[model samples]
Target: MPGWLEVVIRSFVSLVILFTVSKIFIRKSFTQVTYFEFVCGIVIGAILALGSINLQIPIAYPIMGLLIWGFIPYFMGWLSIKSETFRNLAYGRGIPIIKDGKVLEDNMKQQRYSSDELLKQLRSKNVFQVADVEFAVLETSGDISVLLKKDYQPVTPKDMGIKVAPIKEPETVIMDGKILDEPLATIGKNRQWLEMELEKIGVAIENVYLGQVDSYGQLTVDLFDDKLKVPSPQQLPLLLANIKKCQADLEAFALQTNNPTAKAMYEKNADEMMVVLEKVEPYLKQ
Candidate 1:
């Protein structure tokens, strides 16, 4: 048999066998891949080619080797869906990176993620500091899920005894210093109506940063230069008192066990209250 012809036949046979084996064996137990499986794929491809073409070197069997290499992970993904153990085996179980609002340094080192990396992830979730997290889980995909300290989270209508309403997308009336005529039309408005509303707020169209119409057709105006100043030293004591009062109220609410959802809400709020205390560090001592 010609060497070239033998290589061609071996390549074809290797592809068929690799695809068949990958489909049958590899696709059942893994959602994520591990380092060991990757290396095994290369070795398996080489052996299959060696037996088929009687190749002296792996380079002579490049085409089939590459095909088999890609098949391993693809096949493993199929298997992983059907079996939980295989999925867990390929991807490590979720680990706790944070518990009870404290950093788990040991877990961080085990995962080989730096404090800086963890902090950055926290920041993306609008958590500026570590003290704002109640629990953090490092998932199998290396992503983290964060539960915010309750006080720091926005108040749901239910928290304030306000009736919960379905979420509705707000329509933009203006963006980038230009009136969104089409969106305004969709909300049954024209440019003239927007200008009149801007005048009512003592703002010109150019001065508005953003303006949106909610489902109730209520116009909410946001200004570009809106800046909230930190409370003066004289105001700090009052602010702290307000926060403490809120915390106590939440604790009391949580004690009302008749309503499970309200209890959980108050409990979560109580946890968040601690975060608020930590945030106003200077006021605490004073």
Candidate 2:
């Protein structure tokens, strides 16, 4: 074989072996990998490169190096799982860098994390002020986990004791102008329903670039034509408005009626409708 042919064959073999090993043994993302794992990756790539290009070196040597480098990490990972002490040693535990809105300089110094670096990480977390963070920990992955003070944190529905409906994942019924039958079925909707929705918006099936059915069962679509504007689904809002109007009419009737019994019935019905509206407002408004 020509020298170039030999190199190509070696590279192809090395690539297949590397890919197989990676799939079978290595699965962690770069950010999640430990220092030891990172070093092993560099060494493995160097060994493969030398093995592919350097014909003078025995192929068996590189193969042995690859096996050793790959299996040691896998074995260590297994051992780490079985033993807490070994796991902590292999993957260091999270260090508390901030407590009670105060920075722990000693811990930062130990980790060689400077003040500027700490501020930069906090800023990345969307926290500009150190005092706003009630507590913060430096994770083993080098990411900072921050907890904002109660006053500084954004208020949620739970905080206000308001009940909100749980949101479900939206189903993609159409993609690239093609109807996805499986996703349509997953959302408990058929092609006919989707077609009707498209028709309501004056859009054709082929003209739809993407279509998704949200948790509220509202079908939203993106069109291929940028200039064509599609109106949002108003079914929920319209239903809510109609219900409110009925409630108002009942109240008005209660005042207008001369008969005492009829007035009381109208007032009772209006009160009941008001309760129903409050219960469903959260879901419909969303």
Candidate 3:
């Protein structure tokens, strides 16, 4: 065989072997890979490259090298899962770098993590001030996890004792101006309903670049033409306003009525409407 032809054949074989070996290994993002795994990847790629171009060396040698590099780590990973000691040895435990708003100099020194490095990592987590950090941990993957002090943390609805409806993932009913029937069905809607919604907004189906129907049965659309402004869906907000108006009218009727029984009935109905508004305001406001 000619030299180029042999190289091509060898390269193809190497590619297949490398892909198979990679499939056998645990899947992890580049940032999440352990130190040993990183080294193994580098060595495997080197072997594959050498085997692909160097015609003098037998392809079997590189194949053997790839298997050794791949299987050893795979076996070690299995062992790590079964034994905590081995797991710690393979991938070290997370160290607490910050506790009670104070940086632990001793632990930082043990990890050989410098002050500037710590600050840089903290900044990456959007924490500019060390005093605001209640706890910070350095993971084996070299990523920092931070928790802000209660006073520094953003207040959630639960913190204010307000109940909110659980949000579900929105279904994409249209993509690239094409209607998707399955997603429409998933949201318990049909093509005719979608058409009616688009008509209400004065937007044609073909003009929509993407459309998603959220859990509250609101259809939000992005038009293909960025310059063209599409009005937002006012179904929820309009319903809310109408309910408020009804409640206000009831209150007014209660005050205007001279009959004691009628006044009591208006006041009771107004109070009930107020409760209903409170329950639905969160869903509608969004």
Candidate 4:
């Protein structure tokens, strides 16, 4: 084989092999997109490129190098979890940038952040005046986490003495026009119910881009074309929601009450509610 052809073939083959090996060691996360991970990714890419193009370099060396690069940090990550000192050393603790409506110049200097950069971060968080900030911490992820002064903070229901219940994360019912079984099963629902709800809204199953059931059991649907108004039945979601609430109440009551007879009754009633929900699920509006 010609020298040029050998390089070409070797490069292609090496990239594939090295990338496969790298994937075994690397796990991705949102936080991992930070500066450290970005540099780590670039180093791995460079190693793969060198291993692929340079026939002079031993393939085992670059492959091993990639593994070492991956392993050391992984080991450190494990150590960080086990030891607070290691965690603080590897990923420095969040430095206080602002407190009591005053910027901490010393902490900013410690983080090597300039006043301009600090102002930019503050602006990004919608704080124009430093006086408005009660507390701010420069996180290890290079993002500035801020808290506004009590007077500057947005008023909540509690501030006004109004009571409100906590809400759970919204569950996805459908994605890419396909009903999600696992999420539906979570809230005591199934595909049939999803289809029925879609029909009630005059939306074809394929027309929906996404659907979610919120904590209040409200169904929100996003169609492929919003211009095509979907007259989704308000009652269908409401009825299903009521059933879910009833089942939840029964289950909670069963768990809390020590009476075996009452517990059995509650469990049985919850199961019956589930059955009724399934029965009512088939009726879809044309």
For residues 1-286, what per-residue lDDT tens digits would candidate 4 score against the true structure? 6768867876776677656755765566667455676777778779878877787887678778777776766676778889999889778788899999888888878778999999999999889999999889988888899999999999997899754556689999889988888898899877777777666667777778989986655577888897876554366556667777888999899999999999999999989987876666543111
Higher-lDDT candidate of 3 and 4: 3
lDDT of 3 at 23: 83
Off by over 4 Å in 4: 1-38, 231-286
Report residue 68 deviation for candidate 4 (angstroms): 1.0
User: TM-score, each model?
Assistant: 0.39, 0.91, 0.89, 0.69
Worst 10 residues of 1 by lDDT: 228-237
Once model 1 is optimally superposed onto the true structure by TM-score, how far is the C-alpha of residue 149 displaced, in angstroms? 2.1
lDDT of 2 by residue, 1-286 (tens): 7878878887888888888889988989888898899999999999999999999987788888898899889999999999999999889899999999999999999999999999999999899999999999999988899999999999999999998878999999999999999988987889999999888988999998999999888999999998999999998999999999999999999999999999999999999999999999888885
Off by over 4 Å in 1: 1-63, 161-286
> 146-190, model 3: which lDDT tens digit per residue?
999999999999999987878999999999999999999887899
Better of 1 and 4 by TM-score: 4
Steric clash pairs (candidate 1): 27-75, 27-78, 27-79, 28-79, 28-80, 29-79, 29-80, 30-80, 150-272, 151-272
The candidate 4 region of ten consecutive residues with least summed lDDT is 277-286
Residue range 184-276, candidate 1, lDDT tens digits: 999898888888767666677776677887765556677777782222223345677888888988998888677999899899988899787
- Of the candidates numbered 2 and 4, which has the greater TM-score value? 2
lDDT of 4: 0.78
